[model samples]
Target: MGPVVSKFINELSKKPRIERFSKLISGLRNFNKTDQKEIIKELESVMKAMDKNELKGALTVGVFEEIKRMIEDRKLGSDNDYLLMKCIGYWKAMKNIVICNFGKSSLCKRFELMIFEEMNKKEGKNEKRLIGLYESYYLLSDDSIHENLAPIITSCLLKVASDKEESPETEKEVEMALLALSEGSRGILVKGAQHLQEITRIIFHHNDHRNLTQLAFQCAWRFMINNWNSNSNSQIVVVKYMNFLTVVKRELEELAKCVDWKREDEEKENSLAEPKATQIIVRWLDVLGYFFIMCNKWDDDFYELVRFIVELFRTARDNEQEISEMCAHALKMLAHNENSSVDAFEKCGVLDVISEELQQLKLENRLASDCLSIYLQIVRRLSNNSGDETDEEKRKELKRKMFEKLEEEGLEDVITSFHETLEYNQSYYDHSLSLNIFDYFVNV
Candidate 1:
């Protein structure tokens, strides 16, 4: 032990119960800055020693837990020692500690109780506290938050998010509320039927605010996916999110304004202020992807969705990697749904775009792998989804024509080289491509 810390611990151990721990806290809080640093360092040592079971009750009294329980139970309004501040350096640190040191143990329960009780307290309604609660749930899955507390947390979130109309601080509160509910294991939302409806309304009202709308877009998607019934009348279930779809379609139409649908444009780059424009567009495209995956109909702006994705890819030039990756990924998801989807792809001339883009991207190796993945799906679906059904002979005739087209575009060696590159580099970009596209097609 260091001489200074050993001396302090010996002095600390000699005091009686009533004054011992409280006096040490007083010193830790009020002593000269140098001495306080030394004491806190010693206390940290004690914490480690306690954790390691190396210090077995040589010193007495469990002060912090006792103080926490007493203060909360007695409604002692004092912010004693800024103790909670001294602890919880950020919810990230606490989350890592809980997961690493105490995996689902009594200590975790104690920490959860302290944070939740503070959040639910009526007298202290503030942004920082709400944010702390947000981080708590965000970092941990928060299995500690039981069913009864769900309504309370939901109400708290509603109250916080409702303040966006007033001022900036309140707006931040709304942002925090949106993040907490949409993200992580939001136990509050398990009981949030009315809550989700209200948030959806808020999303519509603030549809002009891109960041809020995007986050709220995600929250809305989560609600639909969670409540979606895959078996029982999927149409009615899909119809429930009609308002969400209408809002998204309007916003997407607004974004696609002045967007060039032709690739390699020299003049028409959508060079906008605030790259946030592209980001929000990506979010909207993601929302549309989810819509198509779950809804799976040729209705409800489905044709427009296809048009938008095709334009998204066409506008994705050499510099816009994020846009290209997301466009390709969203396209791939929708394309895999059914046979009618493949027909729509070809009908939209998207297959033609793919052939040309393959020849173009043949040299642009720095581009995203999703570009390759998208076309691979098209070639695979066109062949594999066709079988020995009524149109077998006719299907082969159509496949032959498509193959002739692909071969003319020089995709045969491209596909083989792509498969060989992924194999050689051991870097498979998207596993969903299934590495089996070569088995169904003949060479050039």
Candidate 2:
């Protein structure tokens, strides 16, 4: 070991936490005094030992300022490869700390420019180069700094994902890029809406990789939900152009082919297929549920979406309450859509499924509270819209058929039983939902 590293390690062991920051800053300042690798490694060790508050203290005393200066001085030197590697290593240790405490510091502007400059350089298909720049960007990417960095970040991520490189390093780059996009700020997603098609393709391409797929889905979900109101001109353009529903529809079809609903029980026992496939389906279902609740433009694919959601709900593990709850919530949103027709729900077997679940609940002599609350809300919405047809004669005919089906399925009796059960148990929220369902039924 070199003299500087030996002394730094000795002092690190002897100094208090706050004093360690001073030693760390001093070590970084003396980057040229020791062998670059030895000094960089020891510096990382010192910085990594500090907790958030210690790192915050370090920041208050200008640790990042030292990093900025060292990186700049090395950039002017000839043998930069070693220092660049050290820089990436340094950032790997400091990224999370910097991200959490970035808001409290005034060094954001310099950090932003430093990252952008590194990312913008043409490094000739070097994965390490891209990785270093991306790591730097990941550390600097905050809601406060995203506006300046988003375009380059998006462009770089799209390029990387499109390249389809296969390596552990490339995978890390793609994952970080996708994470940044996934957690983008409110208008950030809307601003990137024009690239939704490319992002959709990336999602499809990476569907086999669970982490990549999850991040991509999260990105799309954020984009859709964040700009849901679309009150501004840019938001309106985003809503008009982005077709997230179509993507959701296509993904559901793909999932349908992958999993055999009838054999799901057997498949669950295979051990190899346990959580990975289940998690992907859960996230996609979450996206679908949120899409229905937020966007009102699903009329084009309403029937297919409903059919797919209902089938998933029908086969969902009855013992796993959260999955069932998500499916019910999605259906409930669909039921409340203004464009939804009673005939469409009837054809898609939605009405039959709800009735069957209610009957099953009676046989079991139990109520799944959350699912029941949403199911009751669905029933009330459907009943209230029994007269949704425009022509008076057709509206009356639809109302008559809906009422007859409701009676034949014993929905009235089961719903009434649910009300009595909630009242007997004195449940608060679900009891209110049940009362509203009864009001709708009585008025209808």
Candidate 3:
């Protein structure tokens, strides 16, 4: 049965008229979702079998005109959303074939521009529907399409960002569209950084819906980071963008606290599932870490990012250890970055909080060796980078403070263990050198 159906699809695909294909697809509307899915899969397979030359021959101006006419027909539009969806599916499939066959030729690029312009004319609620068509194209299309379509996608994203009436769903769709379009287009991101001021305004506006604001900020961070890494001239703009991230990070932290309270209330009432509560906190921490990485500029804002991590450790409850661990991991990554400043780590009191936690865990017999290892690494990094004599004094002060912390925590043994490892490595190297010399002399 499957082979017969496959053969039929292949035979139908050979027909020159897209109108006939549209009619055939429309006839499948009465089928259930599973059957519809199977037909769509079959259509994709059949389309894949046809060469680009064949597909291009099939996609005539007359066929597009007919599809446009069908879209305009109110009865068809209302009764057959599946027809619109399949048209989108077919166009996307053909676009991929052209890209794979032709590479980045002017022919493929011109076709993309024409399709985008046609889709842009779609109006009312169908604007979203049409945008989905382009989005599918963007996702399935090659990176070569980015050179032609990125500006269009950026313009659409800016329009959506500025629209006062744009709903959360539209905002999300637009974000996805932009992400798909920008997948490998770092050049486009560099060109788009000039618009960050306006984008930041929309994101930081007080009445902005939460999810939309988060998505916008996420996009902005990606745009800023991509440009910053590509062009040194973008650093100032990137730093300004980091300031905005600090604000959003604070809001996310507050939101996490609200979620914590809500979870406690639900627990008291026995109304919340454990998985849902866990998801809420996990997402919050994820956002927190994302923003931290974005604000990695070696400035005051970077210190604020570290402070956000410290606050998580200081305020987290017993049940929120997962959140605490996530915060610790993020801080560890930040500390590892060579560009990160020691002053920021110190100003945020991160080391103090870590030492305090280590002490508490030791008293409870729960101090993992991993925590001690992280502490030792942090100390080594700080010591290695402590600058000239003037700064060397500050480094000594920091070392003194660390020793005091060890005494307070009774972690003298952990410090001794770290020194013992260093001494053992030195002795091992010396013995190995002596054995090598002895072997050489005996051979001589």
Candidate 4:
């Protein structure tokens, strides 16, 4: 016999099944670390030289029987890391070998099913063991294995989501693993959105990892956005998922505040580290901005939508142009609703910022015309709200101040458009004038 064969037989003869399995796994470490194609050829050669079915039969029986015997004899300690790692190595080796040869097929499915069946049986007795099985499955990267393993991963994630006793660390690890698996097999996950939402909620609530939460949001967002077109049942699910996102947004806001406060202190001690809180706030604002814009087309709570725009402006310090443009778009939305326009003016700092930008435009480009249009809409709305002489005086004062600002900035075209729109509104009370002005400025 060759060295490898003789060494394997000698170990198998001297050691118990578990110890022999550990040694076998130790011997295969270099093989697993090499190129999978080479590993596959070597494993195939070994399988051919040794009886494949006989080895599998012996290993399966030996492992299962030993586990049972340990349980009955009360000899098995809680720590099963060695045994679990051995199982992981064996399965991972088989998985890599199979993937390097044949693509995903019935043979791989049979292997996955057998592994899951074994895990499911043990899950009833020990959750940690089942988790170990899943972690092992998660570590394997064969796309074929992913395709075969997605449903099982989804089921396991769902169980973890529902189990209150599972630690947040374990849940976060599983969530990341499930995300990686889902990236390889999207369709299987689309069919499992209900379970996915449950997992989303668990992660959103219990886990504190930002990247993990972001992945959960992305996964759940895909499901919700796609299923929005399905039946009412699916639509309801989508809404619930959106509501969960809203909760997550709230949590993120709180965490962001804490980070901001902490970073302020850190900056005092170390001046080189740039604060990333602005980036995080901007990301969430962008998501909220899109969400509000989508919902505002059908909903009447325009003030609620404008509050997010106001928050964006309040938080934005350095990126004035970007925030100003976003605020301008949001104001355009509110301008369509007469009641919302006045509330937006009172609630948002758009007027103050637009005035500042317009002043700066004397030296810079007159791109402040975009904000100028929204300010004009607010003035028109305020003018319309006025009935008495004093209110009319205040309205004209506001309009005169805006026109003077535009004139100083050399935005003659904007000033002329505003005058023409006011005159047209005076003659015909045309709401369409606002629409036309909004279109002209938005395109500009």
Which model scores highest in TM-score? 1
Candidate 2 has an lDDT of 0.53
Clashing pairs in 1: none
Report the lDDT tens digits of candidate 4 across residue range 61-86: 23433434433444433333223323
Give each model a TM-score.
0.58, 0.52, 0.51, 0.38
Question: For residues 1-444, what per-residue lDDT tens digits would candidate 2 score against the true structure?
Answer: 867667766767677756764565545545554455565565456555544345456655265555556656663232333343334323333222334334344444555665655666676445555444544444443445456566666666666656766666666556555544443432254355545656656655556565455434554454445435534443333334444555566766665466544555445444332233443455566555555555544345567767877777777745333455567767766555554454556668766676677766642232344445545544455454344346444445545665776678766777666665565433543334444445535234
Q: Rank the candidates by TM-score, best first.
A: 1, 2, 3, 4
Instruction: Give the alpha carbon lDDT tens digit for every residue of 277-324 in model 3.
Output: 333344444444443444444556666766776786666635555556
Clashing pairs in 3: none
Cα lDDT computed for each candidate against the true fold: 0.50, 0.53, 0.49, 0.43
Model with the higher TM-score, candidate 2 or 4:
2
Poorest lDDT segment (10 consecutive residues) of candidate 4: 94-103
Runs of candidate 3 exceeding 4 Å displacement: 1-127, 133-152, 163-201, 204-233, 238-242, 261-301, 356-376, 410-444
Off by over 4 Å in 4: 1-164, 174-249, 259-280, 296-302, 319-444
